[model samples]
Target: MAFPMQAGPGENGVDLPSTARMHDYWLGGSHHTEGDRAFADHLAMVGPLIPYLVRTQRALLRRIVRYLLGQGVRQFVDIGSGLPTCGQVHEVAEGSDPPARVLYVDNDPEVAADGEDLLAGNDNAAFLALDFREPDRVLSDPAATRLLDPQQPVALLALAALQMIPDSDDPAGVVAGYLRAMCPGSYLALTHSGPDPQLAYACEMFDQMKFGPRHALYLRDPVAVQLFFTGLELVPPGIVPLPLWHPDPERDPTLQNPGQVPVHVGVGRKPGFVD
Candidate 1:
């Protein structure tokens, strides 16, 4: 579905480029403005692998939802969910035996508004406008409570989302708060940009360009990313590059060379047996 792009900094309030819009552009969606396109093009020039990284991250998200569905997780909380698009959590979960409940959370007003409209008439899914850093607000929101059962297992997805949060915001703490809020047997499927030497120039460009005034990119090392899964049991193939994590050869035929992707992804389950 194409989102309407208005002149000037629409609804989101930031004059600078928006990460969500640029991501949409990279995904070949028509939800971005000219400024977002230009910013994405400039970044692509510096790091040609960026678009590939974005696609691989999206592929991993689909894999994650399917994996969770296999584990009998019927509820999902997708934090920092950007523009609604094909292969989103709810779309992937639509055919499950017991219908899945998906709650999409985003701090962007435009994303939230668009999501609410897109999910209209879909009783199993809803969207909330809240910052992922504020776990309390997200978990306490009426939409979340209405769709998610506190007693059941849930899959908390943060695909390519945590990288937008800087270090000073205590990303680890933010993750921990969500873990605390989720019940036992729940899962956390997350993907974050890794600190790749090849992308140093692009990283510098992001810092200097200030692509999004509200969102800053932060690439963390594997050791640091692992800390976010504290007190949880990581699934097999722990913290590997996006394609390497539970890869489905049939689905990702084009992802031949997985080593080129510089995003770390993994799923960790809370330490408790599901009754």
Candidate 2:
């Protein structure tokens, strides 16, 4: 059980770059400590492409959120959602009509604390300590249950986090289980890292970091990644590289789809009834 506002070195190590803070640092957020930046900077040493890839992934997220909102989704459960930043889901969701009720799920206490402090007044928002790998426990979290109504259409958004799970813990199965338990009409929006050839050589360098590269399963092919949405009906245009998925021609390619795009994104709907 994690609590909000607590800060310390984690059991794995202190102040090192875990996925949450690394992402926190990349997104130009303040919650990340120096150690987090150190690791992220180290990753930059691996290749210039890493940072560009990170930023593009974020842009894809922004595009996806707007698209989902346009499609009438009013509820969202964002797993592995890192620290706060501009152009984030909440900002995009509320910026549109039919305001979204969002539940942010991340195991980091500091992120939760910051969210609680910053987003407390929001009637439609709350944050909970949730590990994406542990769906059972996450679904049980009060913040998740209270804000998200399973009977209604809820967007299950997991981006850049699924790679943390190896075969021993099936992220796809986790997604399937979550969808199985939710009422039909629920949507799953996901973006996961894939092995772009350019990123391959950087793998060894990441291994020595605070969170070893060995812990990551980043080589999922497009076909393998598609398994995550097995039972659901993919929105028209189906699963595709992030760049080609609902592109807005008005936006510059650099900002719209930057660097070597290594993530695969899609929105799938669980077919059934709303009851």
Candidate 3:
């Protein structure tokens, strides 16, 4: 399903395939272009487990949000949030008593636009177009200030998003910036692609394929991913493979073979607060 290399702009003058849209395509969402499908298909052909990996990450997100809700964290800031689809934070959060306040952030203009449209009538959620690397901008944005209270605990989610950030951009520092703005009881729920042989080959293929700008994945080892949670207390079962993190048999029946997925996930709580 290779798309011919055509030299023309796509919708919204996007000449390159978008990673967000590719993710949407992987998750069986309709908000994707032919280019996105082509690129996603190419990677899936290389890794074979990519579709499963994507779904596993999504499942992990659902479980993480549920866990956060249980912890009484009512505000959520989902950085690098892609197209709002199934199992989105707002959907899962709003299902609980006293619907959680959510602020979705993404640098992609198209994704941000779609999110704005999706959340138009919903007062509990809002979308902000900003790069996660710019934590100050994300935290200072009116949407964040309005939806999330700085004095209260917040669940900051970076799921499957940090791998897109390269080392040169100071990924750990970026995490620190966001945590610095959060209250002591706040938590960071993160999932990053691990540095495995198969994933390395897939990344190589992705780079060779040249899907688009900022699409190159930076795989990190478990130790490296752990650094993202530097000062926080890792919740029990720290930094494990996707399927191993708080698996709910009833909800995630299809998830099998724990410790097999190359994506690392965990939730770390900021210290210095009680209740």
In terms of TM-score, which candidate is strongest?
Answer: 3
Off by over 4 Å in 2: 1-14, 207-214, 255-259, 273-275
Tens digit of per-residue lDDT, candidate 3, span 19-45: 667777877888778977876687678
Which pairs clash in model 1?
none
| Pairs in steric clash, model 2 | none
- Give the Cα error of residue 34 in candidate 3, in Å: 3.4
Q: Write the per-residue lDDT of candidate 1 for residues 59-176, one digit (tens) a residue.
A: 7788889889999999998987877775789998899989999989887777677778889999999988887789998889888889988889988888867776778898889888
Name the regions of candidate 3 deviating beyond 4 angstroms: 1-16, 206-214
- TM-scores of the candidates are 0.88, 0.84, 0.89
Relative to the true structure, candidate 1 has a C-alpha RMSD (angstroms) of 4.0
Candidate 1 at 195: error in angstroms?
A: 1.4
Clash count, one per candidate: 0, 0, 0
RMSD of each: 4.0, 4.5, 3.8
Clash pairs for candidate 3: none
